[model samples]
Target: MARSAKAVPWFLFAAGGTVIAFILPVMIFITGIAPAIGLFGDALSYETMHAFVGNWLIKLILLGIIVLAAWHAAHRLRVCAHDFGIRADGAVSIVVYGLAAIASAATVVALLMI
Candidate 1:
């Protein structure tokens, strides 16, 4: 039997879901809620964030999170479209995955430029 091309995207979707489930809420708290509530006390300020992103490791982590999240969202959207009786799986797959690919590329480029 021919190897399934579906494996990679499925893997990414699962991994992305795990990443989003585990990390996203903490990120929201750190970047959104904690800062607003003065929990970090200037530790999360603009200059601090700029310096944080200046690190290669941090950049890689951010790239992974953003790209995976994009792919996860894309796959979920595609599945939802099917469930809603969109019926055009081919076109839906192309559009959703294309957007995910574009998002992944953009994330890499943006991180590298940082």
Candidate 2:
């Protein structure tokens, strides 16, 4: 079936944003549970706690949300801007997509460095 032009981006943005909101929180909670629940003679210290949080898996999850949510936020904000007639269509699209792209890039780079 042929999809309408308007439905495409909104579908992607909403799907991505929903997965981020739903699955990612559960993943984060699961990831942290062992540390939070288990206690021992060799219990993790404050520094170790920081390092655990700084691990690659957690970093990746955080980066994913940042990438998805930033775009979602930008798109929503653009729609609101258009609804309010605060800017021309061309300018609004540019501003929204541009910020989303920059946010995505920054998030990926930050994750890579961790």
Candidate 3:
């Protein structure tokens, strides 16, 4: 009965992909487009937005989104490389996952500092 450790990254990738596909666009529109089109007014103002992000719950959600998305992209890249005839999966995994780890760490630090 061997356990497959690969399930962990695959899980993150799937969850991240789902979030990015479903939520990211709405987020982008709210944050980017709505403001530009004057739809949100002060909802996206600096003070209000800062306050929203400063909440612990919001911080956690943002952290999850950022980290999971990074992991998702990394795993996708690794798969694409494999599909393209790249054979060094171990090295590719280390590189891409390492970058994701770095990005996740940076996201945490940035969120904490905000």
lDDT by residue (4-78, candidate 3, tens digit) is 788999999999999899888998998889999999678799899999999999999999988988999999999
TM-score of 3: 0.92
- What's the distance in Å from true for residue 39, model 3? 1.8
**How well does candidate 3 score on lDDT at residue 69?**
89
Per-structure clash totals for the candidates: 0, 0, 0
**Which has the greatest lDDT?**
3
Better of 1 and 3 by TM-score: 1
| Candidate 2 TM-score versus the reference | 0.62
Once superposed on the true structure, which residue ranges of model 1 sit more than 4 Å away at CA? 1-3
Question: Any residue pairs clashing in model 2, and if so which?
Answer: none
Per-residue lDDT of model 1, residues 1-114, tens digit only: 999787888888999999999999999999999989999698999999989999999998999999999999998998899899999988998999999999999988888887
Local lDDT at 23 for model 3: 85
Query: Residue 11 CA error for candidate 2 (Å)?
Result: 3.1
Candidate 1 least-lDDT 10 residues: 3-12
- Local distance difference test, each candidate: 0.92, 0.74, 0.94
Residue 108 C-alpha lDDT in model 2: 82
lDDT of 1 at 93: 89
RMSD of 2: 5.4
Model 2 agreement with the true structure over 55-106: per-residue lDDT tens digits:
8898877777777777778778878998897868678878887988998898
Backbone clashes (count) for model 2: 0
